[model samples]
Target chain A: MLNQLARDVKASMSIYDAGDDKVYGLLAEFAHPGELLHAAEAVREAGFRHFDTHSPFPIHGMDKAMGLGNSIVGWITLGGGITGLSLATLMQWWMGAVDYPINISGKPFFAVEPSIPIMFELTVLLASLATAAGMFALNGLPRPYNPLFYSKNFARVTDDAFFLHIAASDTKFDRDATAQMLEKLGASNVETIHDHGVEDQD
Target chain B: MSTASTDKTLAHLADFHDEAPLVKGNLTFHDITEIVSSHTEKKTPFAWYGAFSLALAGLMLLVGMIAYLFWNGTGVWGLNNPVGWGYAIVNFVFWVGIGHAGTLISAILFLFRQQWRTAINRSAEAMTIFAVICALVFPTIHVGRVWAIYWTLPLPNQMNMWPQFKSPLLWDVFAVSTYFTVSLVFWYIGLVPDLASMRDRAKGKLRKLVLGVASMGWTGANRHWRNYEKAYLLLAALATPLVLSVHSVVSFDFAVSIVPGWHTTIFPPYFVAGAIFSGFAMVVTLLVIARKIYGVENIITVDHLEKMNIIILLTGTMVGFAYITEFFIAWYSGVQYEQYAFVNRMFGPYAWAYWTMMSCNLFFPQFFWFKKLRRNITFMFIISIFVNIGMWFERFVITVTSLHRDYLPSSWDYYTPTAVDVLTFVGTFGLFFTLFLLFLRFMPMVAVAEVKGIMPEADPHFYDHEGDGHHAEHAVEPSTQQ
Candidate 1:
């Protein structure tokens, strides 16, 4: 539940400086997934480590391009499903067998046939909640604002543009070298965004 | 062809992105403004909405009829001592039957990986909710002492009157509420991404706030996408069984009893198939009109309709098979009461209803075997309506005819639907259309983001310039769990 802006607040401002001051880097603008992969390589080759590529849709190979690995969504879903199953089993057993005993047509109070509906409902209910909660947790959702919003151009991201931002925090981040790499990879437009610091934030 | 299909699909994906001069692909801020402002809100063509309004008005009339029936007692309907259920149960079965296709389309199609369903799933789901609402009306109203309806629920009231847990009617309460809630959640979850798509594109503050909260702070992160997909898969899995259980329990209401006509073993699957048959027929009816009205020809193509009509035929044949089986089994069992009931159906007092049910459900769907009629919008629409009529007749044949001529001839009496019965039936149609039409107006009827995601052209690889790099990374072996 970390505020996206709060998490983003800790991010060091990324500034890629081109050697000749043309500063064309900002690889996020690449339209093709393939271009993004090459751009990642170029960043690696140029010895910059803190860049992220973003697009409106997940590209087939974008994870590998960004060197990302397995998501925790599956584990979260499994944990949720287990919790839901146990809770349901407990609720049904307590209500039907222990708390109050009621019989219909000589059937057992906790007849599995009748309780199947409840058990299934609980399983689904629990699994769905877990998925939602897990997703929010993993995605760091409920983030109110982000510094990325300061660059209005970033909004086009919701549209057609793809982009990459090389942060200054990367071990090999040479601003000039990174910008030069982006310029070579056919970026449509690139801007070096500045941070006004935490004091400027209201 | 495989490579070409892949390339073609991949290429078509990006057709909606926001890049070109007038906003490159998909709905840009401008496209959303235009669709919402110009078309969606543009008074909905009085002729079209006027027609919808007429249907809605008729639905109100049905409600009025129900009110009159409830107030005046079950006597307002044509029910006598033997015939307790008439049009109410018929309409109940009809509406509930129609509700099945929605869940089938959404949950089953999702599980089966049928991408073609996205165009109509939202509408189908909404139909499921409204139909269940209509279905709930009957059993509650069918109990003549309408005021004491709450007696079915167990509570800490003054009277210690326990709801008959043994009764199938009580089971219906649980089954229906669960189906409704789970279906609604499944539908809303499906809509979340599209809602986010809508929110991000909205121009005004009113639009922004409304769409924003509904979108639930969706940023479409890869993780969110991953979990969203998983939840959808799980819901689909849950719903697959739910689709079977809801109707099967409803069938148990009749099948558990030893009533001559109603006690057949085939009723469960027969009724289930018939329910799905009628439900799919209704889906076809709605989608045919909706696609034209919404101008989503590409999304809900003729192919989708053709496939649906094919299901109608398949289920209809199954239903027809059940009808024949019922007669054969009744005769073969040689139980005199069962034998008499089967003979009585064809030659009995309400043979018109029996034959009508046969022709409507069995005969009408036969024409769909022709590729032309299945794809032909007008023919398909007319046939869909016929299937609806046929399914209603099927229920009538099952309920009224069976009751009018029971084991003992002296106790037998004919069932007739009075004015209130007829009006209430018409009213249910009104209720269904009023809600369906409104959903069409405000909601993103087609899941725009999902459709966008599936398009092959949407992927950046489709562009002439970027292939080699992405191919290398995608070469990372998939998880070897398989």
Candidate 2:
């Protein structure tokens, strides 16, 4: 019974086996930002869409090299801010003017001057939340597992290393040809990552 | 050039020549990771234990005092009719003021592209959260019946009553809560990259698991970074206005009032300046100790301290000017109550507090005008403490003295904080310190990724052979492959 349970847990964990033939992607390591940029541009010009670079920090021109447009987070923040302003203003006006009106100083029940502070505060509050949420949603984050995490070389991306990964799922992906291309582009180390889906076959 | 002009030009060049490296030591990527992570991964130091114990004791005292006050009532404090807004309000203002510097360093300075902020922004942002926590405590308890605190929010109820949207007190609720939420988000987003770094390096399985979850699977992917940088920039932009608005609204808690001392147009800008002054002082005080304890002096160098001191001097001068202008306006306007309020602040029962405020906020920081004193860690630390004390008194004098002898002389009574009041204030420091100590124990005090970004080695130009056309052509050959 214990042996069965252990086998079940191992199967659920989807541990990658060394002999697995299924390729998740090819990861190419670069020594510096310039090399990574040049490699990214080369990949872009070659018509690859499912490729990405990883570095300890954001490189200045890497976005342009990768052919990425400006992020949509700004638009989302603006939408959220407008929603908050409208909500706050309407809420205040309803409560003080229409709902349960009280004459404190004989001032109008709903005045724009009095409502400005709350409106301003709520706008900023919503805009900030939207920015964080939009960024995470756009980036497809909180995914605790990825095939790239299996590569030992990829670990240094957060510290000292830079990397570019070409997904096997890409229509034009050819494992041997991509590796050769990356090698020519001065990648120090190139490794093939096996997908989690391969574990089912094993 | 003439000889005299050449001499002046030389001096000008000398000013630019004295530029110091923000991060000292020939640090590599591995070295930065090791230096920062060691503080969290290694066993807690003896000094940390000692300070944490003291802070814990203070936190316990704070809890006890709050418990006692709750059991007894507002009478436990020295609050009476005239002096109703006593130590609690004073402490709230003081802590809120101290919270501003973090936002200034992280958001404002970041917006301006100040690279030096990388060394201190993480801890400063943490301080912002903790200080806001400390500040929020006073108003909650000051409400006396904490159970009814929900009424402060604009929630639907059977009573059909809503918070007065026009009241500055209500504005404070929106302002402070918004400030806390925004600061927390900003701080966390900044932490995501560092947390991933920690997760990768963490040894124990439990540590790795916790950090991994906290990091949200950040892989430093370029696509992720593209969005991340955009969000960070927008948050910084959002936070800049939010920071200014928060203190301005806090100032509205006084400025909008009809009270003689509190009613003034200058309160907004003056409060903001004073907030930065006191906040920087608090940062300096905490950092001086932190650097020594953590052995991070190379990163948070004397140059960082000098820069912070210069800010203190500038803001301190602005605050001093505000004081003079307040008095001048009172006299020139010839408003009897306004003039009386200014005179009473200077020469009344709270004259000692007023003088303390002046000497600490204005006179003490003037010592920083001397380059030697600004660079001396010991002197900077002492001056920072003085500034903290002065800021507290400034709030006390502003809140209490103005109300103690208002329009009606019949209700005049001197305010004195009881044991509960005094202990609660001290306990807040304990509360702040305890949270800060735990943060130091676990979280990354320095922003590793940000600091790495500013390093010369991170620059693409650092290793590029721009002058050698042959090598440049050779470098591009690999990319020419089909």
Best by lDDT: 2
TM-score of each: 0.80, 0.92
Whose DockQ is greatest here?
A: 2
Least lDDT summed over 10 consecutive residues: which range in candidate 1 chain A? A10-19
Clashing pairs in 2: none
Report the TM-score of chain B alone for all candidates: 0.88, 0.93
| Span of ten consecutive residues with least summed lDDT in model 1 chain B | B473-482
Task: Give stretches of model 2 more than 4 Å off.
Answer: A1-21, A197-202, B1-19, B467-482
- Give lDDT tens digits, candidate 1, residues B119-205: 568778888988988888888889888887787655546753445444567666667766877778777887776666566666778
Model 2 TM-score (B-chain only): 0.93
Give fnat for candidate 1. Answer: 0.17
List ranges where model 1 is wrong by over 4 Å: A1-27, A32-110, A129-186, A191-202, B1-38, B41-44, B143-166, B459-467, B470-482
How far residue B202's Cα lies from its native spot in candidate 2, in Å, is 1.6
